[model samples]
Target: MTDKNPDKGFVALLGWSLNAIEAVDRFDRRYVVVAPPWAEDYCRQNDIPFVPWDFDRLNERSHELALTLEDMGVDVAIPIFEETVEWAGAVNAVLLKNPRLLGQAMLFRDKSLMKRRAQLGGIRVGVFEEAHDRGDVIRFLKRVNQTLLKLDGDPNDPIHFKAFDKSGTAGHRVIRTPEDVDNIPDEEFPALLESHLDGWEFAVEAWIKNGKIEFLNISEYVTLGYSVFVPATPELEAHRERITEEIEKLIEVFDIDFGFIHPEYFLTSDNKLYFGEVAYRPPGFNALELIERAYGFNGYQGLVLAFDPKTTQEELDAFFPKEVVDAKGHAGCFGVYPRRRVVSRLQVPEETANHPYFEFHELSDPREQKVAKRSAFGTHWGLAYFFGDNAHDLRDLLKRQEELDYYV
Candidate 1:
């Protein structure tokens, strides 16, 4: 796993992920993990290069860690989680001597600011507003439905509420009725509210280097927060060209010279694309792992290449495979949430286990008898993975898992 090439950039990964760590360890780049104190012992035992620092809010003292990594001769900082996105930007700004990068990272963390910036850049987005309290959310909901011209007896369209800073479906909710607003706690206020865009929702993982896309992959969602697969189906891949253009526009809008971006979008029935926010780090739901399964390359390694200032065009070109064409097969994963009100143990459905496409699962036994009340889009207990030559079959297999009980 040692690199013969000594000129490769030294990277500081600003978060702890075993998968990421393992991938980087085998790659050529010299890397160190900058994580919380909790990971100190694990890194020591595993022989991982380590630096312990809590990623609390950036303050005057934040410059100390930046200086620490700077002294270590680290060339770049890569954020592996949402909490560390700003930290990476802050450290990289100092390391790279670019002060504006910190402000740019702020745009990625705040949902309201991100949408406004996208809008200013002429990127289409659904109607959105910032809600400071329950009253603000209810007002936005009423206003959106009123704009849609719904009759008194007609069902109201749901408005989406999301935490301004959290990633994925964390702190996300669909407010379909006024009564639904009551469930939102006061602390969950100061959120972003948007009118739902009804269409095909998908995510794009784009690696950028020197202001150009080095690699891009579209992940089609079978069910948001439940399942996702890489090397999107042909019907979805047909929009590849347009999707690429949108990603390029995003790079221009964000002033992104280099890094990985995981952005969500909606392709409406009319064939237009609307932006649905972007993350400045690896995606959740084991997306990077699924991509590695579909394509024969490590996504974490690709990120290192993108973020490294010394990365050569030849290196970037050689690292990525030819998108869908080069993929050996389709790979997908289903997040398992127990369906039964009470469950005793974990059980993989016979049909699922016997399927030719079945790979493996990460589900475990129930820790408690009572299933906790799901809030918004709740977290899944574990993931079930699949792989196959057929995209349709993989999609169907992933969808079928939702009906089967994983815990019983």
Candidate 2:
């Protein structure tokens, strides 16, 4: 184990992420990982401080992790995954001696409750409702389109159906008709249905300190599920001040005093902003990695800094780079799924591999010849990452990647 400073807070990581572990391992804070028992062997081999705890549903035994970590003198807990967000809340409420943290975590986990909280706080959000069955989903779809006053021949406006607790896009579906609702499995009921917002959708990753904003990065999604770029284009970056204020309001509504918030938003053509949802853990699409590549700071380490109560103001001031100005270049990644239903191999088209912006890719030979029909965002085989000086070019580059063949 690395020598730790006694003055610094000892953090407990609430999930197993190699990137997070490497980050904490290299940082100054003393840390221990609380993960499933299956990870014990890997931790033992790497000499990582670890405690085995299966993050099943929160139950009576939930307090066990808190008591155990308390005895070890742990000062705080940080969640690195969606499953652990509630667990982090449950334990931190005990460790921090604040019972409300658990409720805040639940707000972050449940989409319907979160939107309700936002609305109660005077935040504008898309029309949404909880769905309990296929009948409910169909009724919601018809009602949403009916509100638009569509003629009988006009196509129904799309509505979004998603699992209340699953992380981004896991169980997401866009329904435009009663037939579309039929494909939904019965088990997928008890979901959240939202009227689709017509606007530019983007997400923000902000690290809050002592109930204040420290640093915020806007992640621009070129294509909702396929590709995303950081240090968004000048058009989106223009809203920095407005975005910051919204996040501060979010801090108030969620009663979030510290740590990071990954909230998604929609900017209508009229310049009105709408709240989509917020998550308390790291974002998908390797946003942390993109932030590191563009701004020259480790995002995982930033996560640790955000959660560590002992962190000083001076340290945060020095840790994060100044918004878009400090970005060395715009960084982005494209998720790759086989375009063809049946493919035997993987190939990086020369046009892509030879591009100046191409940095590297994480892909392997086809594991299976049959590609399952993509649901929601679908399961991507891997990601192709790029870095460049122009955000527009980066955005276009990421979007262009969707059409090119990667598997054949």
| Per-prediction TM-score | 0.98, 0.98
Candidate 2 clashes between residue pairs 3 or more apart in a chain or in different chains: none
Candidate 2 local Cα displacement, residue 381, angstroms: 1.2
* Model 1: residue 408 alpha-carbon error in angstroms: 0.9
Model 2, which residues run further than 4 Å from truth? none
> Using alpha carbons, what is the TM-score of model 1?
0.98
Model 1 backbone overlap count: 0
Winning candidate number (lDDT):
1
Report model 2's TM-score to 2 decimal places: 0.98
Cα RMSD for candidates in order: 1.0, 1.0
Per-residue alpha-carbon lDDT of model 2 for 232-311, expressed as tens digits? 99999999999899999999999888898999999998999999999999998899999999999998888888889899
Model 2 Cα displacement at 298 (Å)? Answer: 1.0
10 residues in a row with least lDDT, candidate 1? 54-63
Error (Å) of candidate 1 at residue 298 is 0.3
